[model samples]
Target: MQKDIELSGKLGKKRGNTKSKDCKTKTLILGCVVEKPATVGEIFKRTGFTGTYKSLAGMIRTYHDYGYLYRSGNKPFTYTISELGLEHLENPRLAREALIERRQANAVAVTRRFLLGMDEESRNNFLTEMGIQPVEQHVTIAKNEPAKPDKVTVKVLPEPVEKAKNEIKTNTRTEYVSRPEDLELIRELEEMLASVKEENENMARELAGRTIAKAENSTKKPPKVRNYDELLIRCKDTVVGSSFFNEVPYNLYVVIAELTKASMKELLKEKLDDVLGKKDFKKGRIVLVSDVQASALLRYKFVRKLKEEEYEKIKPKVEFRSDGVYIVVDRLHFADRMCDLPQIQRKSTPIIHHS
Candidate 1:
């Protein structure tokens, strides 16, 4: 019950909304060239990645875009972990923060797209549903219409008005008198109370039954990932929201698969079966991710495929220092989602790291 309340509050909080795809992969990628700069092919060979060379190259390029891996201007560029990337590799929290920031920015982009597509009433309704206060519009009076006086004012009151005011001031407040109760009225009240009691008893029994059912179905083990391609794509193929983009990190796919599983439906409070079609799932599979995981994933996916103009509106504000180093200010409204810690800037004077 407490967890459900926390989830409710988390969903309701209004927020103004990446980095490496996954922590382990990020660590591996960055770790590949910590000692020395290496070409993409060299890094690929070093990591012994099973995925295609093109995917590995793409991932490296994404890291470069985010200022994690810096490469040379020459052809067949050599990739090296930047100062920022080194710091991130050292502290897993930094990577988590970057991932969270990416998710938040994506959320902002997704929200903008959704709200822009909606009419004023529907947009306002959506905002209300998400617990965000809609922007209040000022009332404008028509130029041709006469303005009404806010209050009545008179230097000398009319006779009728003055008489009415006098009566109001002089009048005493009325008091209520109780009537003698009839037997029918007494019997009716008793019957109403009995009906209410019966309803309460029924509600209590229903609640107790639900509680027992939940307990019986609860499990302590973490959720196992099912092969989505085999289960969802090949068997029960249904395009729900957007086309399946394989570019999103493997870890995110695992999370989505785990959360959307039929076994997790009751725990996560979402039934993908309605949209994704029902499958016979094992009873009592433990759900590892929170209810908001799916929402975050959706937002991330949405922002990734945004139109150029739509993307520009919510993109991070990138500013450069005098030395040409860039700083990314995401400007997320929520405090928890934003990285509050001071970023250590690269010094103009370089210090050599002795091995």
Candidate 2:
């Protein structure tokens, strides 16, 4: 009775295992087809199935025959899930469980090669870190085998020491130290500033002294008054307006000589007409005098007539003098004749007497 119970239990377990394997294979095929219509080769490759290609092709044909999947294309047959297959997967709870199992299986497969390349201890430690349990069978195999040298070695520093070394290097690079050369540069700059300050002060003092000296000199005496008679005598014998009035329309010299001989006040156009006894002579002379000789004759006449007190006031006003008509003449023409006449020099030198 005990032997029969044990035998029945073993058979039941074998049947249960076979059922689970069939169910997993069907689920993988359904998942691949539901995701996209694919050929037997694509489905097998994507699902990472361990079955032979021929077996997978046979399984795909079987599914199409059972109406669980439908053929979408021919040459190389492509299969997609049918309504019956979709209805089986429509159970939300079962679908979610299947998806989670598929993800876990993929993760295991992806890391399996890397884990196998590691030694037993390292493999266990890596699996532990990844929250996975290392297989006991793998551990037993590792124990039976001789230890092999590691293919790759990695160096890892403690966190605090690595951080401290980085900080020390950064601080050393950033820290600044003053040298003797810098001190020397600063000292030289200070000396230069001091010398510049001294030079500026000396220049300011010298300028101030010069300003005071000029003020004192200005107050001590006025400018020496020029002798107008001496000025006229120096310019005597030179023709008035000779440089600019080279070709006179009339006999300008004759008119000038007549004015000097008369010893009259400077002649206006009307006075010139009266003295020369002809209106035409006055009109012709006007062109010559107005063009070049007006300003010079006016200046001479102004000085000749100015009194001591009047000279000071009118000297500044002479440049702006507007209300006068004077006959232009060469002073040198009269100088020799006037030297013999005491009255003409006496009339011209009033400012000299006052000074």
Candidate 3:
């Protein structure tokens, strides 16, 4: 049956797209998958005008034409990664060393030429665009030769200077009750500059506080407005752990963003576990979880549009917000879903979605 063959081919490509590839192809695939979908033609363009890229594109196109790469419902007609493509990825490339050298040299060139002029965020964006990332970010403190700490001296009071003491007794606390004429005559100018300085400082502080408050209030958006479930799903796929282990069947992400959007503080109900065999995972959405913290998390997902079975596809049990959420994940994996509401619940508070 042509239809069956086509379906199998499409399934195979999908498997490849999801699973295996050479370094460059993986990078290109990841670039497309995380941010947006792409076609074989687009991938060839990204590889630059090279024979290797054209050859690869030709192969991919052939595969697609053969129905090995089927497009999903309203999704782009993209080729999935196939077992054969995956096998190629595991092979050692003859130009591996040369490619590494070129990449390193190019990185240096970028840092010296373009990156120097860019701001921090722009530089990071550039790195991402280039399919590279900064090795590490660090701040160095200028260590001047160590200075000795300040020394404090105690004054022995110079034996209380008997003459000074007597003079103080005589000169101190002049009891001139109601000497208005003397006070008037003794006037020298006393500047009110200190009081003026204090008033200015107070004014500046008040103005700054008001400005910050206004900005914070205006910028914050309501967490209740967006679909929290979709947010979690997006966060999960892209969130590879600090280290990724495919042997582990669970889709463990380094960060869980549902917590950020769901401020359901009353209950912590996001609990998930891989109890069933990975094959049985499809039918068993109800999981027995070990993490009690996840149980206390609130449920915050907008699945009104999703079919009931589709909703159960993800075992999104977690302790949202309260704890056990990953703080950093690859940015491309987590698409920036913006909040459209003008003003959020009064302040920029973090939401810990539990259920």
Pairs in clash, predicted candidate 1: none
- For each candidate in turn, the TM-score is 0.25, 0.22, 0.16
Model 3, clash count? 25
RMSD in Å for all candidates: 30.1, 52.8, 29.8
- C-alpha lDDT (0 to 100) for residue 316 of candidate 2: 15
Best by TM-score: 1
- Give the Cα-based TM-score of candidate 1 against the true structure: 0.25
**Highest-scoring model, lDDT:** 1
Cα lDDT of candidate 2 equals 0.43
lDDT of candidate 1 over 120-230, digit per residue (tens):
989767765865444433333233333334312212333577566755433422222222243344345446555645655686799999889878877742222222212
Ranking by lDDT: 1, 2, 3
Q: What is the lDDT of residue 39 in candidate 1?
A: 59
The local lDDT score (0 to 100) that residue 28 gets in candidate 1 is 75
* Model 3 accuracy (lDDT, Cα): 0.35
Return the candidate ranking by TM-score, descending: 1, 2, 3
